[model samples]
Structure formats: C-alpha cells, structure tokens
Target: MAHPYVLLSAAVSLDGFLDDTGPERLLLSGPGDFDRVDEVRAGCDAILVGAGTLRTDNPRLLVNSAERRANRVAAGLPEYPLKVTVSASGNLDPDARFWHTGGAKTVYTTDRGAERLRGRLPGEVAVVALGPEVEWRAVLAHLGDVEGVRRLMVEGGGQVHTQLLRQGLADELQLAVAPLFVGEAEAPRMFGPGAYPPGRMRLLETRPVGDVVLMRYVPVAPGTGRLASAADRRWLAEACELAALCPPSRTAFSVGAVIVAADGTELARAYSREGGDPVVHAEEAALAKLDPADPRLAAATVYSSLEPCARRASRPAPCARLILEAGVRRVVTAWREPDTFVTAADGSGVLASEGVEVVVLPEYEERAKAPNAHLSPPPGRS
Candidate 1:
C-alpha cells in the first residue's frame, strides 16, 4: 500500500528562525493556533525530524492534553505517536533530552552510522539504518514497510525542511510566522539555499495566533507531486467501498474485520475466506493466513465484525484458539453467535485467560445478522 503523505509544519520568525540560539523561545502561535495543532497532531500517526532539529529543538514532542491521550487510547492508537529522527552525518546525541523526554523514539541512520553511533551510546531507544548511507528511498520504504508509518508529520530544522521540499516529498505545509524578526545572515531561513524556482501555495486556513499569522496549505496536486502511492490510497478507498456495501438500513447487522499493524497500516484489505463471501464475514479470513511463526505480528491487532468462534467445522481448530496461539494482543468482535454450530461464549474465556484480549462489539450485531443467516440452515432442515 502507499505510505501516508507528509505534512510539514513549523513556527518561524518573520525572518524564518525556527529557534534562536536560546531554548527559552516562546511559541508564535496563540491559544487558537495551538488548539488547531493539537487537532492535527491527534490525527497523525508519526512525527519526524532531522538530527539537527532534535539537537537544537530538544523538544518533548507530545500531545499536551490528557483528553487527547484518552481519545487516542479509545481509538486504539499507540499510547504515543512514533518519533522518528533521520541523520546522515552520524552525528546525534543519544542522551539528548529530546529523545528521552517523551514517547518511543527511533533513529534512522546510514548502515555505516547505525553501528558506529549505536556503539557509542547505550540508550533506551532503538536505531534503524538506512542502507550504508542516508538514502531517501530506503528511508521511506522502511517507514512504510517495517514501521507502517503513514500520515507522517515532518517538523524541521532548516536543512531537513529544504531537502524534503526540494525533493517534492512534502505534501502539505503549515507555517506560523511570528510578527517579530530575527535577522542574521548566518541564521538558517525557512526553505534553504536556493536560487530555486518558486512553488505556489493555496491557503487552507489562516488564524491570528498571538502576534503570529498561521497559514496552512495543501499543495496544488501538480505543485509538489507528493502523491500517495497507488497501493496505499487504494486500500483506504477500498475500505470505504466495503463500508458502503453494508445493508442500507442503519440498524441492520454489520460485520467487518480490520487487520492493523502496530504502525497503523492495514496489512491486507479485510475480506472473507473462499465461498463464505463478503457479508459472510471479513476479520476471520485475514487472521487465518498468519503463520504461527511469524514474529511480525507481536504487536498486531485484529478487529472482527463477529465474535470469534469456539467451534468451527470449516477448519480443524476454532479462531479463538488460533488467535491466542498467534499471539494477537487484542481481539474486538462486533456480534455474538446465534447459531449452535459455532459458539464461543465459553471457549473465548479459555483464550482470554491465556492473556489474549477479547472485546465484544455488540453494538454492530445488527449488521452481522444477515450474513450468518445462511449458516442458520434452510427453514426446518437442521
């Protein structure tokens, strides 16, 4: 699937200073702007930065509201967003308060730098190397594949911002310009060294925060050419299509399965197994293929439109045991079983005691009723 698009956001002085040589810098955006930022960060899957910004900014980089944190938990987002830092020159402070100050932090370096720096300091965070050098393609692939980081927010230090913009990797931008100016020839500007051609910006929204003017934009499709990979976009579109196929009646039974990686990416489109067909079910089929030996699933979660079965003649084993054996951390099922052939009310507990998380989403039962109707057998045929 295509990875998430990038959103570049920054607070700069009228002269484009991300930060003065001092740490006591005040935010340019007022309360209104800060709230808007919270809304943006809440929806993001990850936050990114260059080594330079991490060292200079030393930011805590966390959503400030407890309300937001609770909402994130309710929605099944990671307790914290993934923090990613990219470095090429092998220069980084493993002990920099910036990393330890908040959530999980990961380092991206060249194959050469990964070891050299990792060997230099033993920190709680982990490191990922980007080939033998800092290759952008490799970085993006790793983020999308291994990390599953879509919807990335690239916060910056001048050079990093310049590179992504020049390379057309940035999809959207939010720039907050403080009314004040910090003019110095040596100071880095917002974009970076370029006699470069100018790009157009279409304002999405504007607000006066403190004495700052905040402007947001989505690149005119042709401008940055930062298109979402066809695969990634297709998954989202297909999901919507599947969602629309649910019985038109609002209270009708709806059953769906969602397979999500820790990175927030949907592994495979949710679907059914063989003749069982679409409305027949979706979640169970996705988990069926996961090999018991596959370690990539340690952090995966499966959301089903129906409760897991304690009995299934369709296979040698029931999904409840298979899910627990697969080490699935959480299982959310929408409707309970009405058919005697497949019952889990008792055996589901067996798996839960083994540490698997099982949740019954009775709320969606109506949508699942019709699909299981066929399993109910013809009129008096049982």
Candidate 2:
C-alpha cells in the first residue's frame, strides 16, 4: 500500500486565480518560474495532470532543459518523467501532446472508462481502472508499486489539487504567485472548497523567481483523515527495529529514530548510543547529523520507536523539544513513553501542543517495547 510522495505544483495570480476567463490560456508563471518548474519536473519520477488540464492546457509537460534531460538519462531514468492523467469518463483526445511528448503515458479511470480508453489511447499507453471511481489513493498506490514512482509531481487543474489535498495525500505544495489579478468569477481557481488539513500549512521557504514569488508549504498534520499511511507505518516499524541495534540501557530507554523525507527517502537514522552519548535521545542524535539549513527537513517526518521525551533529566532539552527545534512537523511513534524513567511524561501531548502532527501506531507498541522490556514497570506499579 505504499504511495508516491506527492508534490502539488501550481501557479496562481495575486488574487488566487489559476487562469482568466478568456479563449487563450492565461500565463500565470514567468520564464524564470517556468524553468524552475521544469527543474522540479526533471527530479520527479512522474508528472501528473487532470484530464481537464490536458484538454485545456494541452501541455507537453517535458523537461525543457537539455542538460537536465541528460542528467536524468545519466542517472538511468527515462529522458522525461512519465506523464499521467486521470479522468472519470475517459473522454480524451488521443493525439494530445501529452501522449506524444512524454517518455510514458498512463491514464487512470473507472472500469467502464478503461474499456473506452483502451481502443482510443495508443498501444504503448497504459490504461488502469480503479473500481467504479477514480480514487486518488488507488492511483498513487498503483504509481508507487507498479510504475515505481517515488516522487510524483502534480501539475493540476483545480479539481485535481482539491481532491489530492482534501484526501490528505499530498506531502508538499510549491505555489508560485504571479503579480496580476484575474477577478473574473468564472475563472478557474487554485483549490476548490474542501475541509483541508487542520492548522496553517507550514511554510518551508519563499524565494523570488523573477517577478513570481515561489512559496513552499508542507501538510504538517492531517485534519480528519488517517494520519499515517501503510508506508509510514512500515518506516516506523523499521525505526523500532533500529532501536534493537542500540546497546541495552539500564537508565535510559533503548530507542531509535529515523528521518524520512516526503519522498519516502530515509534521510537520517540513529539509535540510542549512536555517538557513544548515553544521554542523547534517538531523535536528537539523528537530527544532529543533518544540516540545519536543509529545506527537505521541513517536509520530512520523524519516526521513532517511542514518543520523544517531553522532559528529560539527562539533557537540557528533551527529544520532543529537539524534534521541534529541528523543524520536523510530523512524527509517527510506535509507543507512548512509559513512566519508566520520567513520571507523567507526555511527549505526544507536548508535540500536539506545539502544533506537530503526532501519529501513534499502537500496533507496533510491543515491538518497540521489546528492546526495553526490562525498563517497563511491573504489574500494579501504577
């Protein structure tokens, strides 16, 4: 059930319009921002757009820079990222530029729509059916498992962005703001109305790409949706296994921590006693090895065998404090910290209070506690 790390890319006007109500497509991004987007496209495994975008924009979605394409080829990737689109009815033009320009083309649609698209699409193009509806979750899972897509970039129309964000599937959002306003009510907007993730999306960075201002945001927490995906749970379990690699501790809890980027890459990992510092928490130890200025850290999630310590006697700042300082907004932990060393320690609560999304997968609790079973209190100790 592993899904691709989704990066939603879009351009909007100052007033939050994606396009104007005109016959010609409105250009929201400048040449500099366009090049920037092309670089992002080159780095990703696949580029996706809605069928509406394909019909309206007729975008080729190619890696425009020759050097970037060469770099991808040198890296053993295709000349361009795989082109993907989704439609409910499978009504699409077979001769669209997206079909001819990209290295590979895929269309995800309903079962009925698949039959209609199979004959219309090229022989090399793939048509996948996901039940009676085009589910975003299923599309991503198929892309990750079958298509081998790790980083998926979404160049969207409004509905596509809304669906991904509303479903809580998107990891990062790169929004480029143009310096104009399209005040037409009928104009397409960036995102449709939906119950989005709670709290303000964490702004990672802001840079000026020509007249356009590029802003990056991360979905630090889920609002009403499931917090952790199956892949996230697997990573958390791996972190727990890493804890077993640590030397047994009599005073400190044996714990492990891993920092995973939004793209599912393990950025850094550490267990207790990683640097021979018995007092250093696992999350702190792992974070210390990473550069503080790394922008990826903001979009990364920290996985720990146990909840980061809210208060600690061995160190001035606890693991919870350290994780917050490291700019990690999402944390998935196997078990809540027991009062084995510190009493009334509420690491999960501390993280939640600090606006960090904390997901507890109690299914892995036993595995996480196995390494430190000796530290657990006996029955009736409470």
Candidate 3:
C-alpha cells in the first residue's frame, strides 16, 4: 500500500530527555528552531501528534507565521495544515486548543476509542478506527489513500517516535538538541527502550539554530520478509534514478541495481550497459564487483529498478540465476519484466521458486519505466 512520507520531528535535551518531570511542559527548542519548525509545518500536508503530546502540550500545531500560511494558500493548499492525533484509549479533552485552532482535524484510534470520540470531539474532526488496535501502517495508508496526504509530519511525545522508528515506518528524523540536560531519570525521553532498525542512520545535514543544533537523518536498512521499510523505498528510488544513467539502448532495457548488506551498507551499484559493455546487465555488473564468497551476500538484498531477467540470450546465465548463484536471498524491484524485450519472462517467479523473497513496490514503477518510455509498457500496465 502507498503511504505518506513520514518525518519524525522532535527536540531533545543534551542528555536525550524530551522533558523534565514537572507539571509544565518543557521548552527544549529556542525561538529560531521554533520558526524553522513552523516552516516545516507549512510545507507538510498534515501534522500529527500522539494523544500524550496533545494532553501534555495542548498545542495548536498550526503554521504560526501568517506569511507562510498565505504562501500555502497561494499554492492551492489550506491556510493551515491538517492537525492529526493518535490515541488508543480515546480519552481526550475536547477543549484542547488542537481542536479549536486547526483548519481540519483527524483522530486515528481503536474501534472502541472511535466510538467514544465520535460525538465528543467537534463535528469537523474525523475519527477513524483501525480495528481493536491502532496500527501505524493502517494510519499511514489511510492518510495517503483516503486523506490524500503525501507528506506527514509527526511531532511526537516519546512513545509515538519510538513506535514509528521501531516499526521501520519513519523516512526522516529531524532533531534539535538543546544544550541543557534534564537530570531526572524518570523524565520523558525522545526514544524509549526498544529494538530499532539495525545500523546507524545516514546523517543528511547538521546546522545551528540559535543555541540548539538541528540534525537531519534518514534510515538505510532494508526491511525483513514481505514488509517494506522506509529505507527500502529510499534505495529503490536511488535505483530508479540510476536507471536514467544507463546508455540509451533500443535492443535492451535501461535498468539499475544496488547490492546492500543487512546492516545498511551498500556493497555495490551498477547500471545496465556500464563500462562500455553493451550486454552487461545491471544486476550482473553489480554482482561482478563483489566477491562471490563475501559473507554479506548471504543476508544482502538486491534492489533493482527493473526485475532481473529470467531468460537472456546475451549471457550463459540470466540475472536472476546470477543473483541465486551469488547467495542472495532477497530482492526488491520497482517494475516487473515487461514483454518489450522478452515475452513471458518471469524473473520474480524464478526467484520465488528458489525460496528467495521478492518485494515489489509498484509506487516507483513509473520512475523505473521513465528511461524506457519509448518502449511499450507491460500488457496490463501503462
């Protein structure tokens, strides 16, 4: 299912605390950082906070700058971003400023919670139920498929940030680290004790905002089994971009492939027809760059803009067979093999038949096909 790009935004103390153990909510970010956050809110389609944040902060979660709101309206967006909240118990104060100040509001909760919140919240607030428990995946899918939300900003209260990161759903994380420390161990922290994605996150940028330091990071680990992670999408998108660099060929499809270890290390990347080899397949070329006995291949994943070929006349072994021979157990692809080059070629089927996990993200199919636009699309696809 398609999901909105989830950005986890937060401010933490130097010691990693979200707030002190006090009756009043702590202010970790300074004025400059607050303005930067407002700019981010104006660029997003919706702003989400956990029920804990709403109750503790009672924040309006609005674009505070009038000029930014005006610019959003000029761009055909709402004056203020939609306010969203998540609660499993449905216990909330209806008089909270979040209910009275946002342009639109939404609540994702359990069935029982939805029932309790239906008539309690303002009529304009839309309450959606996700079975007996509020699953993060379902909430994001609803936001993308139903609410038409593309960019989602999650300003959390601890538990929400922890859940999103642990579930491999968050695409980016923006953190503003304050210089002070909250010595209380019982105080709320930005993240709780839990299993998170393997390896360190990729740092995109770091800059100073007033006395605080703003840091941006993106996840990189591929997901396990059939569940696709945010990092999987990122690597697959890079593959699609790489496909555009392949030498234009009428006799072959332009494709790109990347081999990544389980710990988010990229082993190799290659595009089709690279290095003046007209018959070199993307997957084959990339695999050739690494040692066959490399231990990482056993747990690594191959990300391809187009599916590996099941049958090929150019080489003794097809790209799918090469991947199997290389000890790879997983493959993530954007587009299936089309009949433009080979008819009835089933690279995915061949991989699956050999006990390999194949994950196809159709959301990037258009991008994977962009370089091959002159060719006919798959029979059932545009």
After TM-score superposition, the amount by which residue 291's alpha carbon in candidate 1 deviates from its true location, in angstroms, is 57
RMSD (Å) of each candidate, 1 decimal: 14.8, 10.1, 1.9
Worst 10 residues of 2 by lDDT: 221-230
lDDT of 2 by residue, 240-266 (tens): 999998887899888989897776566
lDDT of each: 0.62, 0.87, 0.94
Q: What is the lDDT of residue 215 in candidate 2?
A: 98
- Span of ten consecutive residues with least summed lDDT in model 3: 373-382
What tens digits encode model 1's per-residue C-alpha lDDT throughout 12-82?
88877876554465566678767767777777888888888777667767877778877988998876688
- What is the overall TM-score of model 2 with all chains considered together? 0.68
Better by TM-score, candidate 3 or 2: 3
Please give, for residues 1-382, the per-residue lDDT of candidate 3 as tens digits.
Answer: 7899999999999999999989988899999999999999999999999999999899999899999999999999999888999999999999999999969999999999988887898899999999999999999999999999999999997899999999999999999999999999899999999899998899999999999999999999888888899999999999999999999988999999999999899999999999999999999999999999999999999999999999998999999999999999999999999887789989999999999999999999999999998786568985
State model 3's lDDT.
Answer: 0.94
Best by lDDT: 3
- C-alpha TM-scores of all predictions: 0.56, 0.68, 0.98
Candidate whose TM-score is highest: 3
